[model samples]
Target: MSAPKPSKRPIRSYVIRSGRLTDSQRRALDEHWQDYVIDYEPSALDWNALYPQQQPLTVEIGFGMGDSLLAMASAQSDCNFLGIEVHRPGVGKLMHGAHQAELTNLKLMCHDAVEVLEHCFEKESIDRVLVFFPDPWHKKRHHKRRIIQPAFVSLISSKLKTGACLHLATDWQPYAEHMLEVLEQEPTLINHCGPGKFWDEPERPATKFEQRGKRLGHGVWDLLFRKE
Candidate 1:
């Protein structure tokens, strides 16, 4: 059964201004917002059933602090993006930024990406999936918490259309390598590891987290895999 919808007014409404969001981004969010502008509950979502008839959708799991999400919404007006994040501060920041920048091609939800994927989305519905800089959970014991394991790759592959892409970026070489290994080994996906992966990583506005990661000498690597 689908989960019931939450209250009309969001528990927290943030308005981002003079920060990472560009004027154009803010404007896009504003132009596209509507009643039920954002949804925080992921349990009730019926991803397989709720797609807008007019356009295909892309999803981003664990959209850390949401800079890339808003930027992508502005950069690509044709496709809608569903952003799933468990972090309240990040949600507030993204929504605030979206509200401030007037981003319309995006929606919000807070939940576990795994549960949502397994329960909510119907088979072969997603056009693309983006996971950028997810928490590495680097500890040996906590590695189970990492989201890029084989099972996830299998599930993600099942959900994506034949040619849909799964894109992930990480500054941690270890995580990047692990992800590359897993994605490469998966029979359902093929690597798109060309130089353009960096040059064409969906044009996004810069974020503070990225800036900090850069200053710390962390190099970012993007891995693209297409569902077979």
Candidate 2:
């Protein structure tokens, strides 16, 4: 008999925490979902056909409630934006904001971002990827569940075009260090800052959560790596 096959580990970058939805959020999901939300699919996506014009694309993973994403989309009409989050309330909130802003360049997916990148995105198809304030999974035993491991970075690398940037920010110091280490080891990526260094605070609008953390004296670390 052959040696026992290894069991496949689940890819769990997030724990789905159910939050009660506001009436406005429910209204947004009911009314505006078709305009912005993309259901999860296993097939590759044709991004050019999705938007009105082929332009630089940015995908933000785990955008909490989407205040910053809305800001970016509003400020950058030349780029199309996609936001992936497992939280239904966040998705609905983003949709409401997008509709209120009359944004034509934003889309959303309520699913596992890792799965979306693996199955829906073609290699070298994305212009920029943003992962801001991902769950730190701070416990030693839970570190494996953090999203910035080598394999995940490799998969992210495959989805980015040459010279495209992967920007990550975290409020947790150890997790930031881990992100830096993993991103530095990716052969296909070149650090925007030199090895072992962190990037300066970027110009993107600050999210409410980030502002709250800042008020509490929490430090933020940013990492920018380019596909090379």
Candidate 3:
């Protein structure tokens, strides 16, 4: 699972490219990805109507390359998966992984996750939310771009079912602390893991990037929060 670091990364146009959606993902999910998913915009998505079995749904946002998403879905087949990501290439890669795993109880959306939460889904519709290794936004000017801001946390909280879980992970210690601070302000969420939680790594497969991070002597953190 080792790959040479991608070389000569190009500055991509911020414009969304419709061509990036892979055919396999389309064939797998029966989803036709839109060029630009609107923010806080709702689409007609009904869980009960879509799947008669109506299994509990787990939503993962910013799944960098979807390595963990594929692994978790493989291990937990009984639960349905809903993935939201802003990057097109990553979404395309996730589609490939979902297809390769033959995952049926999975769906994907390429839109501002907040919009998905506000518009398409109903209250208590989601059972779990996972945000892993989001952009650190190290630069002071770009701090607003960090995903764990208080406002964003409030929106995410609105989408969860009672007793649902919200899990977050970051390799950056600063952002990890930021996540805890912002989440603490939200009265709706209660920290389920103790002070020892930040020190422990959850049981998960070694991703290509995580393995590399470990080789470089970096520590990864996991935070598991529950809805009160």
Best by lDDT: 2
How many collisions per candidate?
Answer: 13, 0, 1
Write one digit per residue (lDDT tens) for candidate 3, span 30-72.
Answer: 4433321223346647765554357898988876667888888
lDDT of candidate 3 at residue 46, scale 0 to 100: 77
Question: What's the residue-level lDDT of 196 in candidate 3?
Answer: 36
Q: Best to worst by TM-score, what's the order? A: 2, 3, 1
Candidate 2 residues 1-228, lDDT tens each? 899988897959888988999999999999998899888889998988888768899999999899999999999999999999999999889899999999989999999998999999989999999999888987889998898899989999999999999999988899999999899999999998888989895867787677877999999999899999
Candidate 1's residue-wise lDDT over 130-150, tens digit each?
Answer: 887777767877666678989
Q: What is the lDDT of residue 31 in candidate 2?
A: 99
RMSD of every candidate to native, in Å, equals 9.0, 2.4, 9.4
Cα lDDT for residue 14, model 1?
Answer: 19
Error of 2 at 11 (Å): 3.9
Better of 1 and 2 by TM-score: 2
Query: Which residue runs does candidate 2 get wrong by more than 4 Å?
Result: 1-9
lDDT for residue 58 in candidate 1, whole number 0-100: 94
TM-score of each: 0.74, 0.95, 0.78
Q: Clashes in model 2: which pairs?
A: none
Task: State the lDDT at 24 in candidate 2.
Answer: 93
